[model samples]
Target chain A: GAGVSQSPSNKVTEKGKDVELRCDPISGHTALYWYRQRLGQGLEFLIYFQGNSAPDKSGLPSDRFSAERTGESVSTLTIQRTQQEDSAVYLCASSPGQGAIEQFFGPGTRLTVL
Target chain B: DQQVKQNSPSLSVQEGRISILNCDYTNSMFDYFLWYKKYPAEGPTFLISISSIKDKNEDGRFTVFLNKSAKHLSLHIVPSQPGDSAVYFCAASSGTSGTYKYIFGTGTRLKVLA
Candidate 1:
């Protein structure tokens, strides 16, 4: 079966620029999540979307990071005014349903803020 | 503060040997624990999982052991192969909380030397 997918395998952008990362979850998946991994750090939860429920933005580090998921399909994570600290690999994941323990992940998009 | 923590940054094990990866959590509410493996240029893939109700779960060569009293969990891979070299991440979620968010630990890099 098709797994989660992300666009722009790699992106290098200038500071203060805005970058949008896209994620296509597996077909029929009702839960989607976005995470970021900084250099030598753990995967940090950014946001989560489950069906039509309110998205969880508690893990977002700052107000500049926001994500939108259309129904149970595609999702986009936008970072406003990118900074050097924003450089990291953005990963997307999806599960069969809400509260599902196992999650399938995408290849991820590596964003380099230069 | 990091709710999940992987104290070891890296580990090296000889091929065909047993590999053990450890994780700790500060949140007692976490009732579900999962382990994920990741290779370079890819997102994490679910490896194994265990619920707080059970002390252990095993699939093939992978086994996950959970200790609710200690707030710790470990993943054991028997007969580790060179292909097993990658980063391993541990995640925890509180199912009773009704939130779909998961707290991930900093990953541990595993190097299986042949």
Candidate 2:
């Protein structure tokens, strides 16, 4: 893991329950990303993976959002009925698929819902 | 719709000076550009990047500037410190046919006031 890693750093839940959030990337990093940061705003991508395949989920945000990744190195982002604007923070990143390169982050998870 | 826009949410430099941060994009097919730095719950690091055939890019104290005819881009942090405050994001990348991602902006919270 030398870098990206995310999990229950914080979570509240109440609105409609249902939540899951996890990410651990940066071992050979074949892309992988997911973002969402509300409060002060900025960063909202939501999906992107390469090795585990996910050309780009066009930035979820509906259908209760969804995400998945496998051997490419753990990733998960379900969020079924949660609301309260879905709270904030949930970030995770990794890269090395080249092209523009540079990404590597993960210290987030802070959903709230309530 | 919000391709990328950081209309200044906050900024207050002082420690040593120079903090400029701004970004705007309407998509000219992007062409790659980046600048990130967040720190509250962590997540978000990469700090400089620019390539649209290059307008400018630096590292040390950070510097990035590009203006693809006005799509605009900026980020300069000369001496400003206080650990450089935080929250600064601006990203854009397009590369369609072969697939690519990254699009962020809605941050600017530098405070650095030593």
Candidate 3:
């Protein structure tokens, strides 16, 4: 893909089910970030990855929200036991080694918790 | 408390008019600021950015103004077009606590009328 790619553009899951969203960032980019935006609200930072290491995970809403990245490549955000409040569009972005570079975004994975 | 804030939830502008979107931040350590535009079903795309050293930056019809003392910033689009209709987001970063991450605003939706 010429730009960032996300899997299952749309997902509908039951309240108690677990769901995993995937993001494939631009090739050669070293920094990847995950974010969530609920309807009528702004975007919230979920997790950030730099070359496979996650030093800051403070944005995760709860222990149920976990993400993993494989160095500048693919990233997966897993939600354990979805809830109604978990519904939102999960976005991913990649840039060239962080600091001051423009971030390119993916189409995003829309998660709808039922 | 939100480190980055966009007070207006929405804005309306006629084609060929100017569209101004504002953002405020409480963090003084922020060294970089950026603006992003997002459309429905799509992720945000980087529009423009400014470093703390400069108070104003412009690209084509889009200009961004920063006020360091007031901790405020605004984006202006002269002669706004219908295509410019979308949600604009403001983000700030002083460098992640360790790895340098950005903080994003809630977003302001702009409706450009023909």
Candidate 4:
């Protein structure tokens, strides 16, 4: 794809249910990132992947949050036992591995945990 | 405490006026700063960036000013238009050793009344 892509523009899940969000980064982009944005709140970094490995997973708030990337292309963020607090817009971005400032973002998936 | 803080939650500006959004960071290790613009239901898009070595950067109608001593940065948009009405986020990245997580502020929503 010319730009980063994410699946399921919106997800409505019940509390305590599990959900999975997918992100397909731009071709040739080695750096992928995940972030969460709550209503009226600023963005919160969740995870970052360099190639197929996630060098930074420190942003994961709790054990219920986890992410994985395959072949440095498609990435999935799994939220187990979702809570109402987990409701937010999950954004995925990609950039050149060597550049720290330039990043392209996806449309994001709005997860509404009721 | 929030390392990157956007104190103002919302601002209203007239068309053709200048809109100023402010951000502050407590961490001195942040060497790179960026601004991202986000519309409702859409992901954030990169606007501009500035390195620690420089105090100012400008692109088209948007300009970013950095004050290292105060640990503050601001984005200025000249001739604000209705199309420019969106939430702006200020992000900061540490000096390449902080797990590559870019800290983001709470965001400032700009409303341009034409």
Candidate 5:
């Protein structure tokens, strides 16, 4: 089966530009998540979507960061007015559903803001 | 604050030897812990996990041990292989139900010498 996957393996954008990272979760996965991995840093939770419930956006670092998921299949993370600080690998993951423990991750989209 | 911490930046083990990776957490609300392995240019794959109530969980050659009192956990791989060289991440979550807000630690790079 196909695992989670991300598009634009690498993105080089200028500061103040907006970029969208896409993610396709595994089939039948109802829970999806987004995280950011900065250089020499841990993965920081960004947002989460489970079934039809309201998405959890508590992890978004700033108002410029946001994410959306269509039902339970695909997700996208968007950064408005990108900053150099936003340069990092954006990762997406998914699980079977609520109460599921394991989350399968995507290769990630490396966003480089110059 | 760093809720989870992987103290060792990297570790090396000879093939056919034991490989141990350590992680610590500062949040008492975390009830589930998971380990993930990632190779270059690839996504992270779920390895093993342990519940807060349990002290240990084993799966084939992989085992996860949790010390809730010390807020610590470790992943042990027996007969480490050269293919096992990659980054290992430790993640924790507070609730096991609807919310999938995971706190991850900085990954530890592992090298297996053949």
Candidate 6:
């Protein structure tokens, strides 16, 4: 079975530009999540989607960060007006359902805001 | 404030030796804990987990021990191998709070000498 996958394995952009990172969860997964890992830091939760309910955006650090998932499959995390602080490895993960304990993760997209 | 903490930044062990990694949390609400292993340029993979109700959970050579009263957890690997060398992260979540999000700690890099 295919594990979760992310596109544009590495992206470098100017500080003011906007970047969109894509994630493809494993087939049939109903819960998806986005997280960020800065240098020497832990994985920071960004947002998550479960079924058709409103996405959990509590972890979004600021309004500039947003994410959308079409149904239960692909998800895109967008950062508007990127800053150097936004440079990090953006990871996506999915699980069987909302309460599932184990999550399958993608390789992640490394975004460098220059 | 950081809720989860992995005090050790790195650890080294000889092959066939025991490797132990520890994690601590400031939040008493966390009831579920998980351990993940990650390689360079890759996303984290789920390794093991333990619930607050259980003091320990074991799987093969990997075991996770939880101490709710101390707000701490530990992952132990017996007879460690070189393949087990990587960055290990511990995550905590408050399942009883009805949120499916996890708070991760700064990873601990383990080096298993062959």
lDDT at position A77, candidate 3 = 95
Model 5 lDDT at residue B91: 94
Candidate 1 at residue A14, lDDT? 100
lDDT score at residue B83, model 5, on the 0-100 scale: 90
- In angstroms, the error of model 1 at A95 is 1.0
How close is every model to the real structure, measured as TM-score? Answer: 0.97, 0.34, 0.95, 0.95, 0.97, 0.98
Q: Which parts of model 1 are misplaced by more than 4 Å?
A: none
In model 5, which runs have C-alpha deviations exceeding 4 angstroms?
none
Q: Name the better of 2 and 4 by DockQ.
A: 4
- Checking candidate 4 for backbone clashes, the offending pairs are none
Ranking by lDDT: 6, 1, 5, 4, 3, 2
> What does candidate 3's lDDT look like per residue over B5-104, in tens digits?
9999999999999999999999999988999999988889999999899999999999999999999999999989999999999999886454447788
lDDT of 4 by residue, B1-114 (tens): 789999999999999999999999999989999999989877789999998989999999999999999999999999899999998999998747634468899999999999
Off by over 4 Å in 6: none
Docking class of 4: medium
DockQ of each: 0.78, 0.27, 0.65, 0.65, 0.81, 0.80
Cα error, candidate 5, residue B23 (Å): 0.7
Q: Cα RMSDs of all predictions?
A: 1.1, 14.5, 1.5, 1.5, 1.1, 0.8
Tens-place lDDT per residue, model 1, B24-106, is 99999888898999999989998888988999999999999999899999999998999999999999988775655778899
Stretches of candidate 3 above 4 Å error? B96-100
Q: Between prediction 4 and prediction 5, which has the larger DockQ?
A: 5
Model 2 off-target regions past 4 Å? A1-35, A38-42, A47-57, A61-63, A66-80, A83-86, A89-111, B1-14, B18-30, B34-50, B55-74, B78-86, B97-109
Q: What's the distance in Å from true for residue B109, model 2? A: 6.7
TM-score of chain B of 1: 0.97
In candidate 1, how many Å is residue B50 off? 0.3
A-chain TM-score in candidate 5? 0.98
